[model samples]
Target chain A: MSHDKPAWYERARKGPFVGNSFDARARQAIEKRIAGKGDPRRRKSAAVATWLVGAAAVLLAVFIVVRLQDAVPSAPSGNHPVVGAGTEGSGKNEGISAAVVRAEGTAETGKLQVVPLNGEKQETLGAASCMGKETDMQFQGSYRVVYTRGKESGVVIDELPEMTFIQPSADIVQMTKLAFADADVFLLVPQYADCHGLNFYAYAVDKNGGEAFPLSFRMADGTESNASYYPPGELPAVRDGQLVLPSGEGPGGETANGPQDRIFDLNLSEKALVQSPAAMAGDVTGDSGKKALTRSFVFSGQTYTIPYPGDYAEYFVHAAEANLFQIKAGTKKKLTSFQEDEKGIHYVKDGRTFTAVPSIF
Target chain B: MEHEFLKHMTTMDDASLRDIMAQYGSDIWNYAYFLTKNRELADDVTQDVFIKAYYRIETFRGQSSLKTWLLTITRNTAFRYRRSTFFRKVNLFASITSIQSGRSAETEYMEDRYVDDIWDVIMKLPDQYREVLVLDIRYELSTEEMAKLLNIATGTVKSRLHRAREKVEQNLKEVRS
Candidate 1:
């Protein structure tokens, strides 16, 4: 060693005493302490005395937190005004929102094609031919898609495949990319082709401009079915870093009382797709209490009025089942059911303990 | 020493608490200060460890020395302080400002004209390795004692300490050059 160990070790050992020392303060505090002169009644009185002070401190903390939260608002609640879902017959110059659809077998022309979203037979998207099978495809903003096919890779820009050829291998394609904002999230879909028809893969991109890794999903149904997705501006807006993707349609097709579409909130940072209790029915107006009801809840200082679909009682049951929201009364408990009257929705956990909803959702 | 601490704490008297604080307070503060590299945090952690030790003394099964037990509390408290929302937000703001200013610790260290002692280089090591090195050098703790404190295998502590020393030495050589 260049320098002797003992000299530097001695120096480093004294590093804590360089500027500040806690001994005097500690010695003073410890010396002034009167050891356990046991009095339960006095202890109880002391507790009561401190309780008010603690409560005031807590209230002050809460007030500051609320004020700070209000200063920086969460995503605007209510209807997510979509920029546009997709524009049909619009020129390439016009902003065309693109989404990748898995082609079963091949098209009528005996090649993979991108048809209009309206189920109308239109011109295929890219002019470039696919060398092999493409799967786990997703739309990048403005008619561009980052996709992988067999071992070949390409970025489809302006309806043209910028293709790169690579030797096909039996190994499953485990990596796919979702480009949102400036950067991309490298997702590990793992055998994406075989499970294309099974589960909907929603990619929540981190917009803060770094390559985010790991993709997760919340599968509502156990069985496999045809899966579809909506790219960025198509569905409910990404609120407070939470992107709600309508994963799949209900088993019941097109009825007033039919099962509503299951929606999952994709939080990329947490690497979790939380199944939300809210179903995807059309635009839910606040006054329209038939399909969904708008119940306003104050979080921090900001008031968020989201459309609550289904019975208020059923909503709590589902919410508890999903573990999406938790309520704290005396003790923290997942709510079971709720009732609404003159005050607000009263959420019940055990038969006895009932607190209002939106206290801490 | 461990038995003596246990006997004193069993009394739950003023003198017992004072004795524990007098004996272990400086060591705990040094450990915390080295790990956090912040005097304020080290002071807070030292106080917190003593308070926690007072409440949770009954649970201290006497398997480890009182010093190790207290140091364990100090480490946990230090980490908890780091993870708090206020600390995280402050750190995030500092990071953003530092990023904007184009001033990183790496750049600052590389720019340092004078080669200081090994402590400077030791502070530059990653959190895990740096912590192990601090405990090893500052306290001269055995591998078993470290594993008990850190809740890791003794092998991990040994390897991390070795790696931390190597990195510190390498950085020191670089600075000297």
Candidate 2:
């Protein structure tokens, strides 16, 4: 095995050892198949018959399309009324009849043409570009959230005559409902960023419309900042009306005490996310236990890590004014001063102070 | 060896067929397991691949290596099984049973800690990335061969390989740390 190759590659190359029993079974099945006992090949006549049936089906489809085209007259080019429109008060959205119209100049983009089920005039919404072939629309109270899945996936909200398009910084993977204290419904949208992995965004939906924002958490420095958690198989869950964000690592690489779950209390009245008192109590161990320090933050989408000077356990108690080093690529560069706050990690290099959220991983 | 195998494939008897299976059965089974992520399905798909290969040997035009051709058949057979309703029902039942058992075929096979960690990371990746990594690392296929096998552009294969490697490296670092 080459040193450059990942450790798993060698084991994978060897592959799984499907033993003598598998070989015996496979050989028996193959022999039976060759002897024309297992799934015998179709006869030449049957094969020809199947081909003829397929061809007839295609010809019939073409004929039907031609006849339909001749029977139905084409409407005027712009703002044409769609045929077979759904009846009033039908579908998931009651009293709202909507049709997806392909954009005039583009083949991949489309617009949502909303027509009231009560015989109201049809109105055209904003451009709802679909990255993939399929577009999904869901309702949160009266508001409709249209999600387009693909490369440049985005969400569009239809608020009657107006449409609000929300394009997150990264590709949106999925959108789910987040339980909030207020009457307004919030969507927990997870977006996939190449550099940062997966980050969740919270979108608030109200009678006025809907707006997208990142989930914020109060850091160790007693300041509120946008927070992102990496939850792979599991999603953020709500327990007792509190949002529990499970992270793989603590604020920093302080896993000696095991992983930490950050719980947040959503305070819509102050429009701020406050860490729950119970969670805060769990963080501090009466100064006698190990202090789990956070030296990591997620900026933009990527994570950057700031390494400790030496042994973290020894450095925690004795080292106070030691120089900090930031690892870039494989090399570590010295920093004048490093500070961890709610906003991000602030460091001084070449007489300049810069703030960054070093990646915990 | 592939040339010799192909030369005898037309006039292949029971002995030749058994030789062929003996030589490539594990590869086909592993490839099927990688695609379906189920041991039982892998067994069925591997058997089906060989049977299909036996019947379709005349259609093989020597465009690619015999192993690549067999792998391609394995991929298609595994995907067909996945698309079948029977496979879905079985998958659901298997998921429940596995949950109850608290152990999987993967855990049984990969006992080494580092190998198990790597397998976990690879399994967590999206299907597209995982497929490319398995083909490149385990099968040792060229980018062109992978593109041909996946029905994608060579550029797409390269980009996927790059991203897959990056993700694996990053995840491995996290696991080790």
Candidate 3:
């Protein structure tokens, strides 16, 4: 082994620029901490005492809450109506039919509440065990697929009145909802292995309570490819009902014209992925063709772009300022603060408040 | 200079904290990123690490270098993030592109394909192996220092380093073949 470090290692040592926004945010947090409770360095003993008291208070609160919950009469099994389930007047819940809500307890012990968007009707849809706090739900027609990310991540598929949880392979990290065929919902599962890179797998879940199975793809040479492994960052694109993946080297040695894309039509009925014609790849609209919904506004000579119809806790990035502001329901705050009250959305800059209008791009 | 910095760390004010962040922020951020493989989590971990360092500055015994101490905190903080169920929502594959930034255009263009491939292999290693390899190769930490930072024995560190290098070599061979 060489004692001297490689040139690449030296280059890697410099690391990525964390950006000025991060520094600003860190400084802001420190300032906030200092302003709130005085300098952290000066309050070591006080901080410890405060932490102990806080912990005790939290324990007492939890005990009282648990006792109070036990004192209340339990609702009969099945559809348990939740309090404050209706969002009739809430403008945000306009078209959403139903939503998966975290129940009263912690994630490990709680049950997910499937509450109607505009009605008081709610159903207790299984335990929240193995479900991550951060969940991505996709509404496909009437089928609702909730993909959770965590240590023991799994998917919750709700076909209206009935719901089922499917635990994917331990290696699978992400699950993207793909086009469905009949009663089967197809999901693109990306599994990562050490040194082996990421491999894309197709999973078909039957809404009629049938077990979910991995779908194998028929390669161009009539061989079945269980999964196509691609290097990190080279994810396969799903378009129309076909999966367009970059092809590896074939039996005929290296291709003089670079790697071609192998498109596979999802045949859920056959329970297998069949190879489609190469021209089909060109027929579907690529990712670049689809426009992302974004909203932008200028504040203090810097333009900030955020995702449109922004969700709670979504970050708004100001490139020039290198600052990130988190969006709440009606207000954007953190780092550089932007508040939206009854009057209008206000942007505070250098002891001055300016009203700003929101526009979509 | 490090001793002076450590001495001042105990009495670190807002300006001192800002100065410390400026000096060691990228290093902490990069280490956190390397461990967690998520940029957003890395940002959070970096901020948390500095805040933690500021709050717990009196505990700095000066046994390790200031950078190592910061990195040790960074590793622990990153591990805490990894263990947290909330922060585990990050897509690992998508985060691979994050490490490619902060390089000069000339440096990027002049980089050899072999070098890029090697780094790619290094990045894709399992967390345990990658941590050891990065500490050894990138941070240039001694085995003893790495063991201390990782909370493992020196022998274990050496073994993991061997396995990490072996895995990298194996992956590189596969890539080349």
Candidate 4:
């Protein structure tokens, strides 16, 4: 037999004994944590609308939806916490840590938009259009939540689980509790990830109103699946314009190394608002779907006004060390902010306040 | 306790099975974990090895320590881990459980999560190369023992060892620069 050897990786080892230093204690620890922190939505939160009467219905609906979108398990969830390679149980981890929880911010007054890094003239996801208009979203609070950052190609969102984990391709989806026109929609812009999928109930504030809207869909290769998720017209936060086309592809299915401005189509009917008030300052919309929603921040010079993405509508008016603003609508007053609390907003504001929103971040 | 039990334990003694496990459990587990890089998988392999040991203890002709036999099983189990991937999608262990061990806020903002990345690279290596590399880096198993477990000649084992080390060195070079 030829004795020609492989490489150093074939022979060199870090330890000497077979299975000597690995700590058996870590086995149980990891299992416990994963089972515990599988999904942030599983836990009880103050912001998410949770009630007993609708709990069963929520579960049933989410089960049906997530089972439809079979997402890849390894992809990070909405604003997913990354799983990095550390030294095998090494006592000291010199590397930086990921933030699990923090405050939020507010920047958009529903008027001006711009991308700092790219120097591109950006538009509020609110201004985009899709196959349909943005209407009231009717989903249960207890329903499953599938989330992705910006991966809206190939895999259909319908095949995911209620708590389906998806890649941040270029879009996001959520299960709404209730929907209404002129709603705090921009808050629906998922934070962190470029794309995400989610399922959460939106309250009509009136409680009596029903906001049942249609859904939309597209593939990673920019191919539109016949599966229409939401109705046409109303636009949310980040609408990859390309997806708006009936054929999920760029104009005539063109591909390029440059910008595909129309990755997802807004095709929204009305406006969606964040349910909660904003806090902190280090929050500014960043690299949203193909159509990123970004604004400059004075803090770290840049902050994400929008959240990575989740079933919950996120709003942060005062992002820690970022920026803040309080704006006005016709009959409604909105405090557009970035709130990563997973509940979206915290402080409450009435509908009638200002004519046009302000800018800060 | 395991040595004494290895000398005299009976199969019907269910309690002895656990008793024996408590003694050499860490050793077998270490072997399995290093080979698999996943704690849960290691635990599974450890369980299987001990269960087999419990029944086959009577077959020990005193040729090797119980640790050696179990290590052989661990190596074999590692191989099976790779082979089983063919039946699944992108078959490779992410060591996600271990990845979570260091989960925290500060690590996320860091330039790179080295621990997670390192495991990512480990999982990407070919099975043959990965097995040898994990065995060396994690457990430091000698070529002789690896050969015995792999059921190959010592020279062949050395060749694999040599190749595994080279691949790791080249990988380290890329990471360092």
Winner by lDDT: 3
i-RMSD values for every candidate model: 18.9, 16.8, 17.6, 19.6
lDDT of each: 0.44, 0.48, 0.49, 0.35
lDDT of 1 by residue, A15-109 (tens): 53333355565556434333343345545654664555556655654564344323322233322122233444432212322222312111111
Each candidate's DockQ score against the native complex?
A: 0.08, 0.07, 0.04, 0.03
lDDT of 2 by residue, A108-179 (tens): 232122222122222222223221111223211122223222223233322221121122211222345555
Please estimate how well model 2 matches the true structure, expressed as its whole-model Cα lDDT.
0.48
Q: Which segments of candidate 2 are over 4 A away from where they belong?
A: A1-8, A16-22, A36-361, B4-11, B85-87, B90-115
Model 1 has a clash total of: 0
User: What would the TM-score be for candidate 1 when compared with the true structure?
Assistant: 0.37
**Can you write out model 2's per-residue Cα lDDT over B1-177, one digit (the tens) per residue?**
464456334334667668779888777877887787776677678878888777646435465777887887887676556644222342212222211133367754542233344677776666668889888887888866775576443554665676787898898889889
Alpha-carbon error at B71 in model 2, in Å? 0.8
Sorted by lDDT, highest first, which candidate order results?
Answer: 3, 2, 1, 4
Per-residue lDDT tens digits for candidate 3, residues B1-53, read: 54456644434677777778888776777688778766667766876888877
Q: After superposition, how far is residue A179 of candidate 1 from its true place, in Å?
A: 31
Stretches > 4 Å off in candidate 1: A1-10, A29-361, B2-11, B85-116
Which docking band does candidate 3 fall into? Answer: incorrect
Q: Give the TM-score of candidate 2.
A: 0.38
